[model samples]
Every structure is written in structure tokens, then in C-alpha cells.
Target: MRELAGRQDDEGHGRVLERAAEAIEQASGREVIPGGDGELAGELRYALAADVVLGATYTGTLPELHPGERLALVAVCALAAAMPGCVLGDLERELTLLAGELDQAVAAGRAATAAAASRA
Candidate 1:
């Protein structure tokens, strides 16, 4: 089972994920299987769509979570959102490193886009 990069074994990272998962499940009224969707993707998509529609971050849709816990929840939701019609376990394992790189790309793109928009 491949773990996320920069996840130290002694840092209680797994506990963070576990708490986040429980919070997500409780708030969404859906089961969150780490490597499975269980229709949780639909809920996440809906939340994101709602965010876009409202032009605001909807924190109430999820329980109040610490920053680290929120990150874990976001990561788990991201994995679930991308799992549709794919082998969840394999994808999670295979994309471990690629995901980190993609995160960087995503952050860079966001910064670049925001900068360009500001200049325009």
C-alpha cells in the first residue's frame, strides 16, 4: 500500500486521514471507503459545484475541521472524485508520485492564472 509523499510514519498522518474520513462521512451521510467511491464523488462534485455557484467556500457542508484534517479530507475526496470507472486501489498506488507532481502543477497554474487575471 503506497502512502502519500512526505507522510512521516511517526507523525500520526493516518490518524488525520481517519478523522477526516469520519467527518466527511458524517456530514455527507455517505460511506467513504479510502479506495472506493461509494457515491461519495457525487457529493463532492455537488459541493464543488455549489461552491462555484455561490462564489463562496461552503464550509458548512462539511464539519468544522482543522487545517491538516481538511487537507486529508480534500485528498481523500480528490482520490474518490477521480476513481469513477477505474480500479481504485491500483490508481491510488500508481499515482502516488504523479499526484504530488500534479499538485505542484495545479498550484502553479492557479498562481499563474491568478497573476494574469490580476494584470489584465
Candidate 2:
């Protein structure tokens, strides 16, 4: 039962992250190359922030995320916002790492719940 709940949570979180990534990509325009330095970074940062806010709204519920998770999310958001050039690839990598961390947290939570259940 707990496993099911955890899986649901994980799936839901994955969807949210995907949407956030998509939003960021869409707002900033696809096929970002490389170069443009300062101007590109500024544009990316703004777009990323907008995407995060959009994702937050899409989820309906406020994120009850841990500090570390929140920070990672924000870091990725900021990175996307301040992308150096048309570096969509780099931004995607950062987002992937952030999502992985979130997945680890969800797995840990599920494990904890399972341990408690076993004890009970």
C-alpha cells in the first residue's frame, strides 16, 4: 500500500518536472545553440523563472518540498533562466540532475515508510 502511494507520488513529481522543463524550453524557444553570453543568460533566467511558476501553478498544491529539493529546483530554474547561449543541452542536463535528486528523495521517503510498516 505504501509502495503504491510512493509510486504515485514519484510519477506525479516526474510529470511536474517534465512540464517545467517543457515550459522553460518553449518560453525560451527550442534549438538554442551556443554563444550570446550575457544577453542569453539573462533571457534564460527570466524564462526559467516563469516556467517554475507555471509548474507550481499546474500542480495546484503548494510544493511541500524539502529545503534541499527546493534549492536544487531553484538552481535549475536559475540556470535555465540564465542560459549562456543556445545551450539547451546544458540546461537539460541540469534539469535531469535535479529530477534525479528529487527521485532519490522520493525513494528514500518510500523506504522509510516501508521500514515503519515492517516494524508495525
Candidate 3:
């Protein structure tokens, strides 16, 4: 769990990611295995992150958000967007942190899935 601190965009993401993680963890009351395109889900995220970063940052054309901050911004924006009517004016600082949290969750989830598959 590497923390991306001191760099811009890694701000309020921690809180949002924590919330997402909580939601996910709580939802795990049943260990029902998911079927259909699990790898697609993971690949889609990478594609989505790329799309968001490119669209929001205009293919790195816009000189807005620092040199390495677009990805975090995109992640926070995605999380906030996913939850309808989520207010983001408050958690403006932890955006990158949330992104990192998401990265961790995704990684952990994939690892668990792979391990389960191996045992199958």
C-alpha cells in the first residue's frame, strides 16, 4: 500500500475510496462468486481512467492540474459521478488519496479472484 502523498490531486480521494471500499466490503455479506467478464471489468477501468484523463485534460494539452495530477482528478471525478448527487465541494483535497484507495481495492480484488480461480 504505497501512499502517494505530497503530490497534487491525491487529496480527498481517500475518503471517497474509503466510502466505496466500505460499500463494497459491506456488500460482501455473501461470498457469491461473480461470473462473466471479470477481466473485462478490470481492463475497462484502465481504459476508463485513460479516457477520463485524456478528456478532462484534453490529451495533456491543457496546462491545468499539475504535471502528474490528471489521473487522480479523473478518479475522483469518476467516483463522485458514480454516486448520484454526491457533493464534492467538501472533499476537494483528498481526490488523489481516493484514487489510490481505489487502486488498492482493485488490486486486492483481482488478487483474490486470481487466487480463487487457481484453487478451482
Could you tally the backbone clashes for each prediction?
0, 5, 16
TM-score of each: 0.32, 0.37, 0.28
Error of 2 at 48 (Å): 2.3
Q: Of the pair 2 and 3, which is ahead by TM-score?
A: 2
Candidate 2 lDDT over 1-120, as tens digits, reads 122223334455445555555545643454344543424444444445643323345556643343244444555455444443435456567545644654564455456555656666
CA lDDT of 90 in candidate 1?
A: 62
C-alpha RMSD of each candidate structure in angstroms: 11.9, 8.4, 15.9
The number of residue pairs in model 3 that clash at the backbone is: 16
Using TM-score, rank the candidates from best to worst: 2, 1, 3
Selected candidate, larger lDDT, 1 vs 3: 1
Q: Candidate 3, residues 44-110: lDDT per residue as tens digits?
A: 3343343333432323443223333444445443553332211232332343454466566445544
Q: Candidate 2's error at 39, in angstroms?
A: 6.1
TM-score, cand. 3: 0.28
| Top of the candidates by TM-score | 2
Clashing pairs for predicted structure model 2, backbone only = 32-86, 33-86, 44-81, 45-81, 45-82
